[model samples]
Target chain A: MSILVDKDTKLVVAGLTGREGSFHGLNNRRYGTDLVAGVTPSKGGQDVEGVPVFDTVHAAVQEAGANTAMVFVPPPAAADAILEAADAGVELVICITEGIPAHDMLRVYTHLRRDERTRLVGPNCPGILSPGKANVGIIPAHFFSEGNVGLVSRSGTLTYQIGNELAQRGFGNSTIVGIGGDPVVGSSFIDVIAQFESDPETELIVMCGEIGGDEEERTADYIAESVSKPVVAYIAGFTAPPGKTMGHAGAIVSGSKGTAAAKAEALEAKGVRVGRNPTEVADAASEALA
Target chain B: MDLLEYQGKQLFARHGVPIPEGRPAATIEEAVIAADEVGYPVVIKAQVLIGGRGKAGGIKLANDREEAERHAKAIIGMDIHGFTVHQLYVEKASDIAEEYYAAVVFDRGAKQPMVMLSRMGGMEVEEIAEKDPTAIARLHVDPLVGFQAFHGRRLAFESGIAEDVIRPVGTMLERLYEAFVGEDAMLLEVNPLLVTGDREVVALDAKVTLDGNALYRHPETAELRNTGAEDPQERMARERGLTYVKLDGNVGILGNGAGLVMSTLDVVAQAGGRPANFLDAGGGSKAEEISNAVEVILANPKVTGVLFNIFGGITRCDEVANGLITAFGSLDISVPFVVRLDGTNDEEGRRLLADADLPNVHVEKTMLEAASRAVELAGEAPPEDADRPGPSAGADPDADPEQ
Candidate 1:
């Protein structure tokens, strides 16, 4: 059993006619996800690789029975696309678009909180993949194998790197969620860890975090209190100088706070084994499961 | 992007927030002229981005032309916190009757815009919070509902703001909120919000940090990126559209993603070598982007060794190999390079590098081995003629280090 998606999911791709949307939209469909509909304003009658297209999310929901939305709209219009999905009563929205302004995300976040029906994943993230059941967003589904471990991270390629390492060690994942590296994302580490804890298939959890905010330290407290599943954590940016963003907008060290050593120490104090590298992370996961 | 004090005041003035009248001067002559125009008893403040300028003797009060010139001569070109002061902000001094603090910053844990107010100012907010938690009144504003007058009034009353200035302070909060939203600022702080003898509130200092991602919407503010104040290597990376941060070490580091690059730095440090810089070529980086990243990393004169750690996802190792080849073709590389390529198309990438058999370039299988090898190489004696002029060699001719 996966946390966010499964065989019962009916998917709709927002901005489906665009370059990235069409590419990954078809990729997800080829992976056997129930790609039901597409949304491209003023192009309702058109279709993208056998999926029906609608001008609005409401039409896609009413006619095609789309229960979920994967947004690839450009950064400027991406926030409105998510709001439109929520307005149309889509249960879950996953935004793959990067570079949406933080101010816009704040408004979208506040709106989603009030709406309460829709759960948003990312505005700048590689989407979730529950292997053998569903594939979503940009995660290379081939790297993952269906098993008992659950993976969540704030990075894209780094997540894939760890997945490859774990797979090499004979540890497959139940579900992999990329909550994004933006300062204000839809979900946090604790939010996804809680899901993994309740899932029957997920016996172990691996969390990947980087420097920036106190999210990792806070997640350490949450894991100590609530998560009974064995958790292995990896944090990055130990040598990062203060007040410089490495690559991702949120991957930075501000003053003396948000250092990787501090994060690793915090997780270790909570009885979690913090990996020093991706290979170490997989080894730690293997030890926990063993 | 942190705005200098003068730039922050300019932005505040645009948003109708009261700020002391000031003008920025790049030369001592201009500073004295500005002081003359602003009248007597002007403050000559160094226009540097780093904090603690006051403690560094970068700020001085002048009563007349002779004093203004002397202060400007002392402040200009002064090195404060490793940043040379190329400009001075001359402003008329204020007669303060009271001091307060106010700021609007994103509360990351709560995922909301937090408005903070405190009657205790002229000190670090952290000190205030630690000394007395209740000294600062905090309120989170929902972007959907927006900040309103009641939010400010509540904070004022909670922080025990004087009754006579509560209404004015509340109005100031509204304007500050507008500035925060309109300018796309991540942090807009007015420390020591001074209440003058005339019972008027004016911002004595402005500390603003705008969202770098949102700068595309603010072209005018985007142009305020002080090129003269930036590290030459960092400025080059910015121009090349690469996310790079300059560090003080010898092992130049490059990788595909932020997390991976950061991990590389940590691994290098753990292996007993300091990283020269952080350069993330980004996911799915094309051959050209990799070439650019290599150039940027090598441009740092402090780099004695290089490490390329790529964990391919969308970024294929073969493409990275091609980029490395291209860099070798274009650049006369002197330092030793250690490359660790894994994941998608990694074998192919390794084969390409083996076929090239480039001089001084070694390929390792894991991040640990590569970092260890790079550190070992960095500890070696430099090859003859490694010493060369840096990109910023002649950029600042007048920056006297001993000033």
Candidate 2:
């Protein structure tokens, strides 16, 4: 069984009238995701890619019984969309939009934690895909193949690269979750790992992290204490110069606190095979299963 | 984007944080005039982003006009942490009776703004946080309610801040938080918040990092972007909305994702090649973007080869191939290119590249092989690559693209 979304999931597309929202909404639907509703305020009677649109998330929830909300609103309005979805009884919110102000996220997160109704995946992430079952955000649906291994990463392209490597090497995935590359993402590696650990189909886990905050280190600690599944890890940015942000807002080595070396050392301490590169990571995950 | 001390203070001053009166001067004459206006015993501080200005002799007390001119002359060309100073913050120096550390920085762990205060000030905050972790008081603020005076008071009380200075420090923190939130800053700091001999709290230094994402809302702050101190390649990349960092190597690395780009750098280094730069084409990049990236990378003469390690997810490889073909028609891309395309519809992309059959392009199946090929094409001398010291990533001494 997949951890996040599966065959029965009904999705709502937030900001469905926008460029990427409508584009990815169509792509996800083409991949067989149950995108039943769309939300674009003041366009309640419209349809995008044949999905029925509503003025508000609550109206979509009422009319289409949409449980999952995929947000593609701009940065300034993304937090409001997430809050609206959470308030309107959305079970899951996957925000594919990037560049949401950190301050906006701060308030949204505080609100999100207080409410137990919804789970938000990202403000700047590729979102999650449960192999052949569902494609919630922007991850290309066809590249991933259904299998026993579960993968999670803090990066978008790196996840796709490693996912492709795994698929090419005859190792398919049960679910690959992009927890996002923002400092204040909706889901953490620990949150996804907990879900993966309980899934019977997930026999092995691959965690791809990069130099940034202490999330990897914290995840490593959690793994050492609780996880029993065969886990392989790869921390990117070993060759990256310190203090210079390597593209991602979260992928920065601040004051030597978050370095790739420190992350590798932490993970290796937890009995996780740490790969220096993606190719090596694929080999390590393959060997872990063996 | 991290602001210079003077720029940071400007935002603070706008938010009503009491700071030393200062003006940024780019020339010796301006520095002398600023020093004269501020009166003698002024501080001529290099307006660079990095810290340790005092230790690097970038900060000097100018007792008179001639001294200020001399100090400005020495500092304007001085190199600190590889950043050559081009401007100086001429400010009326304060007579410090006591120094206290205060700042509101983004704490990633908390995922919120954190207030940090310490009686032990004038030292590097990073160093203090490492060496004497408990000496500093920390408070996490909820952005929903913003920073409360109670939070600041709690920090002051916990850190054993002097009783008389509590109100001033607390008020200063409230205003600092205002500046941070009002300006959409990721990191706003006032290290060594000095209490002058006249018994008044004043920010002696400021380090503000405005949220690059939110800069669109604050066009005025966005206008303060100091492209003058940036690498020409990096500046161009920033303007084009592409993330780029120039390194001291010959292999110009381009990739779709940041993590993958960083991984490409590592793999290239493993293959005995140093990455000349880090450039992410970003997700869903079309033909035009690919062409732009190629042109930008090729513009760096130090780059002997280009490596395009693309795992097409949202960014299709076929689009990149189309971009490369379009670029070759106009751009003088003399360097050999190693292209490794994989992921969604990769074979179609590969076929397109093979059909184009550009002489300088070599398509590889694996990242390792592609990196190896790029390494070989980047002038086969790893030892010399290590020996030749190049300009720092952010600071380019001679960064004129025309030059």
What value does the lDDT take at residue B366 in candidate 2? Answer: 91
Total clashes in model 2, counting residue pairs 3 or more apart in sequence or in different chains = 0
Per-residue CA lDDT of model 2 for A173-200, tens digit only, reads: 9998888888788889999999999999
User: For residues B99-171, could you state the per-residue lDDT of candidate 1 as single tens digits?
Assistant: 9999998766577888989898887777667677677888889887889989999999998878899988898
Query: Per-residue lDDT tens digits of candidate 2, residues B89-110?
Result: 9999899898989988887777
- Model 2 chain B poorest 10 in a row by lDDT: B394-403
The numbered model that scores best in DockQ is: 2
Model 1 residue pairs with clashes: none
Tell me the spans in candidate 1 whose CA falls farther than 4 Å from its real position.
B380-403
> What is the fnat score of candidate 2?
0.65
- Error (Å) of candidate 1 at residue A20 is 2.0
